[model samples]
Target: MTGQLRAAIYARFSTDMQRDASIEDQIRSCREYAARQGLKVVETYSDRAVSGASLMRSGMQKLLRDGRSGLFDVVISEGLDRLSRNQADIAQIYQSLLFAEVMIETVSEGAISEMHIGLKGTMNALFLKDLAVKTHRGLKGRALAGKSAGGLTYGYSAVHQITPNGDPIRGDRTINNGEAAVVRRIFQDYAKGISPKKIAEALNVEGIPGPQGGEWGASTIHGNRERGTGIINNSAYIGRQIWNRLRYVKDPATGKRVSRLNPESDWVITEVPDLRIIDDALWEKVRTRQGALKSKETGVPVWDRRRPRTLFSGLMECGCCGAGFSKVQKDSFGCSAARNKGKAICTNMTTIKQKDLEARVLDALAHHLMDPEAVTAFCEAYTAERNRLASAATSTRTTLEKDLATTKRDHGKLVDAIIAGVPADQVKDKMIALDARRKELEGQLAQADSSAAPVRLHPKMSETYRERVAALIRGLADSEGMEEAREAIRGLIEKIVLTPRADGSGLTVDLHGALASLLLLATGAPVHRIARMAAGGQNDKSSAGAELQGVDMIDKSVLVAGAGFEPAAFRL
Candidate 1:
């Protein structure tokens, strides 16, 4: 707080070919810069083989979350593009960090301002788009030349061409007889009347490895047929190659690539006689059978058997293996990994009935609110904290207004003196100096107004927190408000860790989130005071030690102590 500024270092590289030492090199440069500026490097974050086009990278998310939590005074990165390549994402990140009073310093741009975010962000975004276009064009050329455009396929080995400079250039692929024999068997068996499921089972029985060195499943033999991904369905096996049958684009919500079918007009079909494994006669027979099977299914009457949506679809996780808990049956949720594979894959085979889990969560909430004294203490602490933040914003606004008045008044006097009969050059020089100072003051005032403290819960909101929480819990029992109630629970609870009982009868539920923080505040310790003590490098454990008891305590003690008291989760 006094001498050295605390800095969090962020580094990123976009491709796997880049050495792992890239992160270290970036951090080393940042450390040198920090030392020159008299800053203390407190933490470091990095993302490897991650595209900067999005902010979905794990390290970037952690950096932003920590920034909001006020964990450090400044963030240092090698460049603005190292943080993000998307212009909109750059702007959002800049505003959020600025509002939190944390400065972002880059080695290339120095301390980032709105101007840097705008100009550098646009440049980075353009770079990404141009690079994508060039890469696509190169791949398209390779495909048209009957060469391997991407990774090696299942039944082939890559053929490399050595340049005069002794550098090997990857081009075409040659058949791998060992894997090609297996591929031929899959096509022959499927064409001879064996189902894909039976073929997979036969391969597994023979101890044959699947494409990726794993046990084969029916889906592996019959992948997205339109995209030419499956072993038997691929046209490359029959003297023809299909390229660009599908294209991948990033999903906005998850930032993961989702494949969509490209029109047949866009596909590049090439004749590669050397790559053929199956004869045209066999391929035609297999295609005819597949068409027949599809036609039969298309004629069958479809049943309206859509399953009802569950309340805790994405919230549950297994305590044993840390795998997601998915709805395995109509009324039960089980370990997804175990259910998808076999019980042998995962040791924890516990299943929880949906009704039981819901009841326990509601019961726990009711029990926690039963104590009036604890509720009163939390409400009072939360209300006072909100008022304090609002008061700070008001005070800062008042000071900026006073400074603006004085700057304007001095500017007017300087202008009047210039008009009166003073030497033109001398008066103009004075006036220019005054005008520059006035503009600086105005900029400062605008920033102060724009960076007003974040909105927090008022007294009125806190007073009704108990009733709203109770109503939400009770509403979970009704079918009508189940969706709203589910969201309410998720807002209050970060995750519901269900540790299976040793006896295998039930689960021990552990709650985490803003409500858990209330356990610490019930003892009358203010969150801001604890945060201040923490910021000053002082340890304060008395609050949590006295109030939070037993083994059900949530993780991240600092987060619990510093989180604001807002009832947004309790709102219906």
Candidate 2:
């Protein structure tokens, strides 16, 4: 490396518990190293309070993007672990930088390489695992001693104290008198046959703050019975502390932690009489009521249900407060916030029959939307954009083709030299580098060709769309394949907003269809299957929306061109 080499500094610290100045310290050391080597620091990137276990951090991603764009010649970090603690992630970063012809230098490791990534990555991963095990052990001891093992439950406040050695005591809590009174009131209300939704509404009306000082919600009161969550299910109010009831594991694909329940035998139960908020009589009464309610709704748990029963179950929203519209009765839907959080949150008390709402929305989808003129205009616009993109891709493909030819020609020369009695070792590395470049260029050319492939729209796209929608609507009437048809139809809708009419007639409905999904449905494609494939086999509700925005194929104004209904006063 020469003194004129350009370098980018990258630094990161793991958690909020760590000092913010840790990033500054790491950057300072990297800068000092760069100065000592006479390397020009072109830029610096830092991720504060972000874990190195994942490469999803914004700063790290930006660094990799810049590296690939040839913004710098080298990356200077505090250590290899600062880049990533995950073995696979570290290896990926190394290969990416290698391909970009960028070097990685660290203060602790000097220069990173394949060997360093393997050994140091393993050590860092082990450190994380060991730390987790030790932390869990300490928390388990605290739970066994009847101290809080996790977050402070509602109706309690953290009790901070110092030990004899002047060390701060952790995991101690005391009952909050005001919150405890509220908890008792909730138990009394539930035992007296008041539903959780009604209790939540009354509490909100009284201006009582729910957990975390947020507005009260029915789900906050009536939590999962199996998970023993929610205010009512929390056994801490009954002088019992439960620990290790659930374990969380990080999803490899998403880098998000998902929780799994532990068996009852694995749960640790401890008694703490001093923290009790509800007496035995009130507790038993609440439990009995909950058991009776559970018996009444015994078929399938809501979480276990694969799909919603109704066509517009999760699609309706309240225009006034931007809250969801849910089933308020056996045959109608209304603003959930108004019904559960009271008029203070939302004044929209308007309700619409399920049959009527479905009929209106389906009619709009089949007839008003997807006009022939609009469809033809959209096809023309898509064709023009596709040609423009193809033209750009052709230029890129040409460059890649030239580069691939040059690489192959150079590789051939090295091979010829070796065959002409030249030492194989002298040209082995050069030939290998040229071969890698040739393959990379070929891959890029292949991708460009695929993207530039022409797409043709059906001539009678609007008619096809209407026919598909009609078929789906008719399928809703039949029992066979009804669920599949329902899911497909639902996938096309983004949301349906209902607002109260100014003249007090009734609620006005506004439907927003996902443009990409509508186009796919119009082309006789399975919208649900395409969306699921895009989301890696998961049913992502927003995948169609994402594709529409990312592809930029359709104009927004064309969405409801022929629909007679005026646009809603507000958009959600």
Candidate 3:
């Protein structure tokens, strides 16, 4: 029986700071142990730089799956804690393996039992808690002593030195003159009523690197106010170092860390006046502007708010500067960069009435788009792809049904064994595992069965598309289900480009409809291939708009409208 038994090696180390060779060493030791135990080492699994606190690790999950499938009769790890540190997780792992008739043996602990899991898991959990408390305490002391307690802030550089006792001095920082200038400029510009988006665009145009040394974006400058995260909210700019303002906890469902605000009483504030980058007056001005903006937003009704309320609010772009077009007045949209960052960044100041723009776009979509030839081409390609995917899904559903049937059979055998006088304790874990696997397989089969049916193209697809567009236009005038119709129509458009007419008369509109969305709207069937293409398409307006200037399709994937000076002709 030992000679026939198959063994699998498993190992894990918590962080990148640990040695990569640690995994190799653990696996080698496990192989040697398996050889001595007269078992064939058939597979190896390891998770590098992954914590034992969660079973979300890919390697661990694969090991469990293979065990349940009866690929391995025994699992070897360096220690019980290597599998899991949490008591509940370790117990669950044990039960899962036991139900699958797989034994776990650690090099250090030998064969694992319930007693080992309970004792070792509790010890490891306590160790993690103690480590966190001690680490926080040390950081708090460093903060109180006027030293950096976290990652180095953007405008500061680390000062490395050695203490007299031969220990390295950590957390000392000095102001970076170059970065300090940028920080001061940001504060000054925001104080003068420049929006964060405008500030970011202007800085990017001048080739200024952001906090992470990449292209700047509005969110980088206007981070969450309540969490005090953005550049403008950094208290360090005012000679204050605030520590413990937020606490992070791991989300059990997703195994990701999320931050929560800590009480002000728990905060540790230190004065590092030498590192000051912004003056009190400039800081106060930024705070006042932030407050005023917040108040203005709160006082407005939700429907009339400055946020994206119109159909094409976020999809409109300026042809001159490539910045987004936003509402500049009560009823008109203009280039945001030109109005906010001045003419230096963008020269286009053209504005168009919201009503006129919508009317023109809707008219183009209904009358000029949806050519018969293009619709036919899209239908053939879409039907072939949909049928291929449907076939693959059917094969997958068959496999799931087979696995589910096997799980149910195994569970019935365990029940019969219990009824025949086998101790329930001996096979209870296996029965539970089989039941869970059966349910999981059944769920997957149900999802596969519920997938959209194979698409059959309508003979008059283009006509249907035109009729749908007309209905959508009518829906805009009605109050009931207006939002739904607006979203449906908006989904068909990738973006709209607005440029100042050469004669300085008005804005020239260029509408680009997404090919995938158009095909879906026309056929009333899902087209997975074209949908992926549209989703993954580049958003660089300069290159895309130039390529689409007078063309119907760019690389046979997009539909362009307003190909020439006339703004009402949509082509595909």
Tell me how candidate 1 scores on lDDT. 0.68
TM-score of each: 0.60, 0.84, 0.64
Better-scoring candidate (lDDT), 1 or 2: 2
Off by over 4 Å in 2: 1-8, 34-44, 55-76, 91-105, 110-117, 163-166, 295-308, 398-441, 458-460, 526-558, 563-572
The C-alpha RMSD of each candidate to the native structure, in angstroms, is 10.2, 4.4, 9.1
Candidate 3 C-alpha lDDT tens digits along 1-572: 43588899999999866899999999989888888888898999999999888888999999999998989999999888889887778888998897577999999999887668778988988988988899899999999988999988989999999999988898999999999998999999989988787888788778888788776766678777667788998999999999999998988755678899999999999999998899999999988887777445366422223565787778888989899998889999999777655565678988999989988888878876766766566556556666777687778777777877888888999999999999999998777668777776777777676554544566478798888778877988889857667766776777788888889999888777765466566765333323333344344222332222222233235554323222242522
Candidate 2 lDDT score relative to the true structure: 0.81
Q: Tell me the lDDT of model 3 at 299.
A: 66
Off by over 4 Å in 1: 192-215, 295-572
Model 3, runs deviating above 4 Å: 1-16, 19-138, 162-168, 185-208, 215-227, 247-260, 279-282, 285-308, 317-324, 328-356, 368-375, 386-421, 452-457, 494-572
Best candidate according to TM-score: 2
TM-score of 2: 0.84
